[model samples]
Target: MSSPSANASEVLIVSARNGPIAKLTRDEAEQLFLGRRTTLSDGTPVALIDLPAGPVRDRFYLLLTGKNPIQTRAYWSRQVFTGRAQPPREAPSAEQAGNWIATTPGAIGYLPADHADSRLQALLPLR
Candidate 1:
């Protein structure tokens, strides 16, 4: 089936090639990105990186949460205002996001599929 996003951009959940995780479920991914999760099923801790505000970032959240950027922003605002959680650390660009994933141990993030490379391992694809 097609994704709920308007564009349905191909995005991949990724970690450093040698990172502890090998894969993740959609529910697991959602929880992690939303800051409600920090460890994988195997108990390996993870950090989340994010692409700066743009089409790719918007598309990623839309595919993951079925929420547009505005809605997602509001959700995060509330999360922060209430001190419940913090959003992921955003990189200046996709390249930077990928680099952070590659060098930062246990760092996990989403990238446009075409931007991922050998240094990273695909954990899941949000189609």
Candidate 2:
């Protein structure tokens, strides 16, 4: 699964020695990956992020939520106005997203599965 950013890279998760990262079930991952507010197995909050709206974001949204980006945004907005947690932060690009996850403590985001590069701590197998 080599990609542009990670031509010869291995993504190894770097997490706390005493505990696990917030791995999620597929269903849960779908929810978070699609910009729905989701929690990890340990009940930690998961923030789903994507580049502002584009082809890849559209595809990811559809794959994860079975809906288009516009619909996802509408749904996310409703969740926010209703006092639920905010939708995932919108990073401008893969570079911005990587930077955000790299620096933001207790936060997590994803990139191309192959290019994840262990930049952010990888969650365990979702159970």
Candidate 3:
């Protein structure tokens, strides 16, 4: 059997400085990330990190696009190849991803719930 998944999933919404103070519903996160619409009221692209390929990502996959992370990578790669938009930065782990997003401007990434720190905001509670 596959290994247990990460600690938790937290969807954080970031702003210029002080945000993701606002929490997000699972559905809202679904639209933002998988939609890749980049035209939300805040007008920033949603960012997702390299989550382990397992049940946690699976649940998110179903919630978002009904596709796996690999599929999402392919979709973003195609977009990048065509110069339409850029894919979200890929981090090795949740902490690394959080560090990147927390420092970068106009960035939003999902991190495992317990891992959420002052650097990153927690959006949704673990179920």
Candidate 4:
């Protein structure tokens, strides 16, 4: 298990590899995570993965989009209802998300900073 303070403090937006994507601004990170942007700046299509619901997920949205979990859920619901976009695929745990990010090309996901490793490239750090 992880500590609440640690989970709340930092989130790392990561990709499968470095160089392919060096970094992203907060706005770009938010857009990509929210399904508003389907590709990276270099035109590479990305698949967004999400951690299962918890403090980390809640903090991620709050920091990135200024929305709480409920608001974020409603936003995605509206998008799906209107046929605009789909929410990110959910990973059961940070380790699983890391594994997916490591193997899937153009994959992106957020994990507690403590969980980050060489398998993925850190693209953005959200508080």
Best-fitting candidate, scored by TM-score: 1
Candidate 3 lDDT score at position 86: 58
In model 4, which regions exceed 4 Å deviation? Answer: 1-8
lDDT comparing candidate 4 with the true structure: 0.81
Clashing pairs in 1: none
In the range 52-115, model 4's lDDT, one tens digit per residue, is 9999999989989999999999998998789888788899998999898888777888888898
What's the TM-score of each model vs. the native? Answer: 0.89, 0.65, 0.58, 0.87
User: For model 1, what is the C-alpha lDDT against the true structure?
Assistant: 0.84
| lDDT of all predictions | 0.84, 0.56, 0.54, 0.81
| Model 3: per-residue Cα lDDT over 4-25, one tens digit each | 4325453233322364324455
- Of 2 and 3, the candidate ranking higher by TM-score: 2
lDDT of 1 by residue, 1-127 (tens): 1223413368988989877777788888888877687787778888889999998899899999899999999988988788888779889989999899999988999887778888998887877
Error of 2 at 14 (Å): 12
Q: lDDT ranking from best to worst?
A: 1, 4, 2, 3
